[model samples]
Target chain A: MDDLTSDVMFEAFGKTLEEVFEASAEGMFSVICDIDKIKPEESLTIEVSAEDEKTLLYEFLSTLLTESEIKGLFLSRFRMKTERKNNQLIMRGNAFGEKMSPEKGGTVVKGVTYYGFKLEKTENGYRAQVAMDI
Target chain B: MKGKLKKLSEYKWLISKELMKDMRADAIIYANKKLLDEVEEAAVQQLTNVACLPGILEPVLGMPDMHWGYGLPMGAVGAFDKENGVISSGCTGYDINCGVHMLKTDLMEDEVKPKIRELVNCLFANVPCGVGAHSKLRLNSRQLDKVLVTGAGWAVENGFGVKEDLNRLEENGCLKGADPAKISSQAMERGAPQLGTLGAGNHFLEVQIVDQIFDTGAAKVFGITEPGQITVMVHCGSRGLGHQVATDYLKIHESAAKKFGIKLPDPQLVCAPATSKEGMDYLAAMKAAANYAFCNRQIIAHWIRESFSQVFGKKWEEMGMDTIYDVAHNICKLEEHTVRGKKQQVYVHRKGSTRAFPPGHPEVPPLYRDIGQPVLIAGSMGTASYILVGTEKAMSDTFGSSCHGAGRSMSRRASLKKFRGEKIKQELEKAGKALRSTHPKILAEEAPDAYKDIDMVIQSVHGAGISKKVARVIPLGVAKG
Candidate 1:
């Protein structure tokens, strides 16, 4: 289902909201590079908030890209927590990865586009989707 | 949507607003019959979607290279009354001022062809690329602000390039409205380490050789001499800083649209009135990002000269490494155009389209006034790219706009599945091109055949007179970012 004219989209699923957030980041990082080979040599923290579940997912993923760029790391592993604060949803997480090199990746993920964005809670789990502008 | 189009001429098709009650204006697509068939109905529908916006002038333009994108289709143009019309971050895209910069060298292809691989390898080392890769040059907040305010001029003042290089760029490489205060600190943080570095995914530096010259007079004006003349092309844009600006403004404009009582036909097309505070802020910040992009290219151009000098064992001046032109494709401009014999200022939004103002236009540099501004249409990696001159037809019809490049015909995932990078590399080598990249999949995703035919796209614009061909150049060596 990775069908975009200039990008690739994917669905990340997990058992809970925190797991879903981590899964979303993982999915995006996988598209950016070979996430399996990315070791957790460095660690960085990320904090973002949005109005609702879907918006929170969007913000969290988009924030991960910026955090990665600003910190200069190829983030792969993630741990996230969600809470309601000031009547809005807040997502705070820690992302871990190693420095980037040519061999570790090829496609440079530009940003997370809302072209096919979604966050749905199903019978068994939560599923998040994003279309990255590579 | 295609059924709604009425063929006005060989290259123009009109989609009457009468077909849709909500459309405030008509939409026109500049494509021939064959090219028209290739255009997606969704993209044409998006044109009509643009027509529904308030203050949208008639005939929202879809260039020959039009393709389906997230919001506005790539290669589309929309002009709105500056005072009454709306400004959209989605319309301008996330990459502010993502553009092409071309340099024409006096050296011939015969001498460079033998050292193509060495040149490409040297280029790969000199230019920092890849995702999350830090640039060699680091800018503090204060210096970064100056970069945003002055654009390429900062680069020139820093000795990255000469003073004459400024005149060859659009807006003299700096827009006056750029105010650093309008942007967020997040943008500054994201932009600090990225200046002068080419980011990956579709960005590339190509060493080219002139294959053909059609308009010799315009070619001479651009310093493009006979066939076999050498040139280098740099394609990139404002990196994370531009994205951060677009991200911040998209949220602000979305709320502002509500505050202003503007009805959004599509959420993706969220915009504020051009004069609204949110809109003005976005405009100022967008200009800053565009300036950042201009400065980025100037630095890349200087590095290109350095790389050539290092490889050729000659100073850049000795090799005639003069910039022909550097122009943006994804941008918005405030321009005055005659509408029904009455001149009015409008905000023209070009998404994956280039400004193609004709000869004698005030914006045209003096050296090129007799001819026109050089419009470099970037083809995909290993394909034929064109150098075109702005024309009067574009002025009268499309708000002085022209096609940007050979738009992608296939999806990235599909291309990666269909074309093996190793095989493509071999084929390009067979055709005398030396290709280099971080990984082979980068090659696969940007496979030359995955893009539409540059020849056909150029023919449509040339035949329509929106832009006329000056010279055609093919890649001899490419270092993909």
Candidate 2:
């Protein structure tokens, strides 16, 4: 959130781009609900393909958000693996979560925004920033 | 950016196209000295950005509550030629038709004040609140499609409220050409369970007291008769569905803008020409989402009526609880307005601004036509809200638009760090206002101090002859989702 717009931006880092993607998912879910309380009693497969790494991350997050709402769940755990195919980047993963309950309270994010969204290489590993409309 | 702002009046400022080479039209900002000082440079840059867009009219107007938003600023208006102008889902905002609806009652404040806590609690329970809350009424996808087309009339037909509500609503509670087919399955799924639910974040249901009346004639026209009168105001919009529509179209327009060869200075301003197939489809879809919002508020209003009746042990009608007016704060409308004495059709995109059509405007409801459309400007929590009447100047100057609320001055993060929810709740209690919320953090996030002084905002618009104050209301109790 900024003085100008209430666009929620969060940063996460990991050793590889896949880890960065997983962390970004966790960060966004954490904004929606207390992830610590979200029991991973059920797991679902996640597959998304986009033009590039940045769009891949965005689509990955957006897919999770839509799936969560439709399934009446609050997702917390994530694991992702990505591979390039021709001009497209495909990512397949599993999202673990439990049903939505007020006990696990937090804000509801509308969607992931490209605003301030970034994925870049670091000396040690990789980092990503995701902005969302809450 | 500072020197570029030419002071046009005590309450108005302008930025000429000379400040930016690509700008096709001038940009105007309505603000007093105090609000002008808080206007962000980026927000001004946003207006200029809109000015540079294809088919933009003479002047891009930013209301008194203007702040930096996605593409155009929130509380900003960008009028474009109907046939050639561009329509931006990103610029119209994610929460489509997020608006304020005011209801006036015959009861006195003293009658309602004593039972304020019970009333607030009843409203909270009756209205499904919180982000995760589901609708009390579950409808299948087909039934939901009816809501997408009928808007508030769906709720009225389904026994939530009466038919009179449709008459008092903006656009009769439904926009034409709202094709449900344009809506995605994901949006439909998201909207299905959340129709009557009030999602969190600045959205609220409040019981208020009309503390003062600024215009007796206009007040009477809107059923705001006496000072100390009891009223109810709701602030919310289309939920996940609307957000999804915007997200979906933002992606569509991203490609559509490229296909149409429309250059955008910012990605958030991605748009399609109004006459393009993509643009029409997005417009049809946006109108559908907006209609969903209208239905959402209407159902909530019915529940509010029931809550009030239960607490008072009287029929809602007996208390003269009538829908005063419902105004959409975020919308894009195809309307006819006179520009330099020439009547032309234009798409007026009021991102977070309210329509304030002057007296005798054809769009104003028959009951309010003589006095002008009722512009309900919501205040930040625990602040004073004003009921204003539209002016001819608004039609001429701002495309018949006014500010939406006490615009936020600080970010949610800053406010949460600076304020505590429990402390704020206790303060409200001390001030004789009842408050309730699902989450404590939301209270902190929406601390009144985080918002601009709404009084100064009203002053600027009133002084600028855009909207005239009618009545001032203060919350007696609040139920926040």
Candidate 3:
């Protein structure tokens, strides 16, 4: 993907994730499959509501990663939707995780942690809170 | 949200009952006005929450480096009556016994100045670092068990270090009552290959120079002096082992929290009564992890000695590569202290705080009794690390505990996005410091900018009379994960 296209895709991922949760995204993502080589063949929908954006993002990504690991799926596509009312966040998203082929091993994200978590409003757009497992 | 901070003195602030609900006792935070303003809201709120724990002593104390963390704020010290208190895994953090070890070397900066890059290269090559970093020496299940049970003693017995080194370590390099059997298989597997590795995020091995000495007597006792005398500080923990142990117990303790009818203000502070089976099991496993960390640093220290010997063409003994001290910043210990004018045994939880046992305390090593336990507080790379001693005031006020370091000021993401690692490296190098790392991103995450000012942190504790500063060591070379 070109730099412009990649930037657009990232922006779309951020906006869609925020729309479903009603809060800014404040976590990280891992490409479960080789982004350049894999095709999106299956997807799983996950939704969770949490008291705050921090916990909501943590639970949302953690659920996806846990489910993906157990079912042998490799997440290749990501999008989110959010709604916030009275300081509560309702987050919903579809993370596409294709079944790993025999020739291709899947990438695994251990789990999301509470470090470096943030959710804030911006002038032009929103950014997801990001944290690394390692 | 600003707390109800009543100024007890120029350096002390008290959070009274008016600040929050369910407080069992007042919360005392030591900081000057400037330092207090830099503290995050979450940190103060967490201190209040910690104050609400059952059986807490009269005051939940926050040290100078206090910052936001899982259950208790980092640099918090709380003691509870042994018969009625609770133990929370969050109080110990995921990295059980994460700490700093300082080694004094005869080689001065002037001697190693031309070879600083080569020295760092040697250290980086010898010390495994970064995410999932594994050491060359992988331990079998039985050997790993020995590590958990014996700690640095295991390292000494196996010839990783000399017997003298144990004398300077807290608890003589091993916390008794560690039961390897209590540790889970997952924890064992994670720890097996990570015995001597330096895991990522704030972990480093730095070569420093004793740039200043504030207390002449204390500096002489610590054998640190002058602006050019060289030292090495290793910062790490039990690696995957500690993380897995904490993870395993969190699940167990969460259930225990309900069974014991303990209502924690934060789910992360899941805990059980100190006498409960779950609590005992967690403590056993936690101590085992703590031992693993002690042994991990011992082995790494051995490797550092070897690296110096190889590069300098002299034996470590000849190079004066002697250990000054080893201290654990995350731990809970059962100790007897005066509470309410009577001696009582209490479980003291020091998260991101160091135990600063005063002189004559039997727990202090014999060699340090004349002086006091050497408290190692590591600052960020390019900053100043300090050598301190436990004070009588600390035993009375904080259950013998003090701040660990200049607590983090900004999140890693914020730090990385704001600064470039290459630029940071260049700046340090220009300032006569050497930088070596396997991953540049790791360097960015732990930039000095991410932490509070070390000078202010030291001042607060020194002013509070908890831990007295001995010497200040500044960095000459740094090796990061």
Candidate 4:
């Protein structure tokens, strides 16, 4: 459910860690623009490491927003892979979208906020909720 | 314990110290009965949460426009002893030092009305606006460092504004002890290209006409002499740079809180002791971000001058366009205040509030010292903004703080669902407002109907004797991101 104050909330389910991360990323992009209309004309790969899955998810989404601001790109599709090394959670991901033009770029997404931010395991799959500052 | 508020006066309400077992101080709110009814219960809960923060001075306060925020309520103010307090990034909000700067002009409505449309169009073309909008001037790493340390002074040195402009800015346009090294390279990257841009979501530049004057003496001191005189109001902040700094520090505080053994009622309120390395680093980085904002507004002010000159066929100075004052609404400032009859330095966090220092205060510029600080209150689109002066009553009652603006009364989602951008644009046009924006959807989301009545909100603060009304200005044209 969308929070009434200022931020938008996303909740999604997936079977794998990568799937959960990808769903969370998609949910975030939808807050900025209509997801179905985005055409993936280019590809970008992003890698981040954290102590745990929750931190990884936050960094991953925050990185996407930072990249969007710096490179002027609009990302719509997300592909992610996670691996553990030396007790560290490493996430490698590829995001696909086209350069931002007046038609493609939607509302300005400020950044990802930590309010009620989470990634969790469910009975059947995994569920995640991330709040975006818009 | 369930939240229960007791009326202390017509304009003040109190949440007693006994209301919550962990609360270190009572929570006091400034609001009239009508304004109080509009506040959500969740906002009161958050206010109580603030009361529970460590080393909090008694009477955590909320302005008349209080609303629920992630950790602290927007329009919330809290002071803590410098030696024992903790600092939370969430207290300052994501938009560090987000504020408004007002400019007064000698031109009158009759002189500007004919070219209002052209002036607005020129501004829309000159000012970069909207999401991820980039600035034309690119700064190297060294220049960025200078911006972090020098603030609006850097813009003045670059010939953007006169040196006198710095004097009218809050904190004289820069907070000291800002360490560029404290800012992350990634945050610098996000900020480098976004300087001088008006970011999306409620940020705007408006052309206004002074409609009425409440206090002639104060109005005269503020350079507002006649009704129908023209002015400009700019509302924005340090764009991606500030947001990035806040984002980074929130994560740091989350871990710092755990390390310090500070039990947080909410993850968003995670904080560290003020003297700790993490807290000190966050403060330094936050100051750097705040400096970026000061310089950002100064640069935008320069562009606004250019647009005016292009439209009026005269230099901005020749037409008398100069800054009145600039005030930060979302910020944490360390200042000296009297606590229990003893003067002490405290870190005062004002999120969605403005500093309202009274007359003779050393912080008030010498020019306006006798008249008190000018508190600029920006109204919603299609509404009348106000100018108020600070008072001693405010200094004692709310730690020299006042409401920032007419706080949001409706959700953005509900606004989008209920109104069409095009329809809102038409309504504004019909009301004699010239409008330009990067996206039409912003017009719908920021419709005046979506916010509390600014006139009533101002009345509450005025009635409480914290901030006195000086003049009212109605919008003539607006440009938004």
Give the per-residue lDDT digits (tens) of candidate 1, residues B1-481.
7987899999999999999989998888988898899888888888889899888987799999898876789999999999899999878878889999999999999999999999999998898877666688989999999999999999999999999999999899998889999998888999998998888888889999999999898898888879999999999999999988988888888888889998877777878999988888889999999999999999999999999999999999999999999999988888999766788999999998999999999999998988877899999999999999899988988899999999988888899889999999999999888988888888898999888888999999999999999999999999886
On TM-score, the stronger of 3 and 4 is: 4
Q: Give a tens-digit lDDT track for model 3, residues A34-103.
A: 4445456887777888897656765776666545544445565666767887867877777664664322
Residue B266 Cα positional deviation in candidate 2, in Å, after optimal superposition: 0.7
Listed per model in order, the count of residue pairs whose N, CA or C atoms clash below 3 Å is 0, 0, 17, 0
RMSD of each: 1.3, 1.3, 7.1, 1.7
Each prediction's TM-score versus the true structure: 0.98, 0.98, 0.84, 0.97
Candidate 4 i-RMS (Å)?
2.0
Please say which candidate is ahead in TM-score: 1 or 4. 1
- Pairs that collide in candidate 4 are none
Q: For candidate 4, lDDT tens digit of each residue in B1-481?
A: 2237898888888999896788899989999988888898888888888788898997799998888776788888988789899888877878898999889999999999888889999988888887656687899999999999999999999988999899898888999999999999989998888888877777899999999999999998778899999999999998889988988898899899999998786677877888899989999999999999999999999999999999999999998888999999989889888888898988899988999999999999998999999999999888999999999998887889999998888877788888888898888888777898776777888888888889998998999999999999999999987
Error of 1 at B219 (Å): 0.5
TM match of model 4 to true structure: 0.97
- How far residue B269's Cα lies from its native spot in candidate 2, in Å, is 0.2
> Native contacts retained by model 3, as a fraction?
0.00
Quality of candidate 3 docking, DockQ: 0.07
lDDT of 2 by residue, B1-481 (tens): 8567999999989899998889989989999988988878888888888998899997899888988777788889999999878988878978899998889999998898888989999998999888688789898988999999989989999998899888999998999889999999999999999999888888888889998998998898888888889999999999999999998999999999999889897888989999998889999999999999999999999999999999999999999999998999999999999987999999999988999999999999998899999899999888889999899999998999999999888877788789999999999999888999987888898899988999999999999999999999999999886
lDDT of 1 at A9: 90
lDDT of 3 by residue, B28-98 (tens): 89888888987777788888887788888878988888887767777898788898998888677677898
Q: What is the CAPRI rating of model 3's predicted complex?
A: incorrect
